[model samples]
Target: MQNEGEWEAVRLLSTAARLVRREVDNRLRELGLTQERVTVLRVLAGDGPMKRAELARRLRVTAQTLGTSLVTMTRQGLVGELPPAAEGGARRVVDISEHGRRMLGRADEIEQVGFSADIRPELRRELVSLIHDLEVHRAGASASL
Candidate 1:
């Protein structure tokens, strides 16, 4: 016999995530930014300049995936690649552009207004913990593979 009213945890989480993504994306659209782009901008702004490979690790994405975004972002003037740190060396250092920072600031404003008090602090902490745990599990699984 099956339980009459079992909760579907994964389905609920997925739906909530989709809705939140939609809302955030819509808000970001006003600034000509997407969530992915905003994430890159935030990391660069917060961490300062670094190589693309290092950026990829910080972003939790593969080099090739980040490369595609970098190409478009560079062309769109949201990011820039600088000369090697050494005079006679070769390295790719990237940083967020002024325009990107402006957009990120706007995005921050939108996010602050849109979600500042929606979720309770306890629930938010639980969600964050859950996400961290999942990421750790995922990394361990990938390593095993």
Candidate 2:
């Protein structure tokens, strides 16, 4: 009916996203990075240090999910934490380590190469608009990313 092409477009986008993730993950694996981890690093780099809960909220992930990622990242020396009592005495704050910053730079390079496909400018604009619209539509006014 009215949703004939819509479903196929969404399915294709989903499939393409998964394929891109897989390809990028494989490349990032060599640098001890994943797209998810890179995203965390990027956000920290942009927003500066933030409490654990705040970071989880900004990333739109559960605290428990972020906790697991933090464990591994902490062990890898990619992130540093300031204890609650040591800082404002509230909650632990997380920041990207210098190592994480350096790795993020390398990851950016790898990602650039991976996404080197030359899409038309119009297509790029459409893709961005589509993503923004979808986020707004799905999450209402809270999708400010």
lDDT of 1 by residue, 1-145 (tens): 5442464878778777788889888988877788889999999999999999999999989999999999989988999998875567547889999998888889888888875347788999999999899999999999999
lDDT (C-alpha, whole model) for all candidates: 0.87, 0.87
Instruction: List model 2 lDDT by residue over 8-113, tens digit each.
Output: 7878788767887888899999988888899999999999999989999988899999999999998989998976775457667899999999999999888778
Q: Which ten residues in a row have the lowest lDDT in candidate 1?
A: 1-10
Tell me which residue pairs clash in candidate 2.
none
* TM-score result, candidate 2: 0.80
lDDT of 1 at 24: 85
- Separately for all candidates shown, the number of backbone clashes (residues 3 or more apart, or on different chains) is 0, 0
Superposed by TM-score, candidate 2 places the C-alpha of residue 25 at a distance from the truth, in angstroms, of 0.7
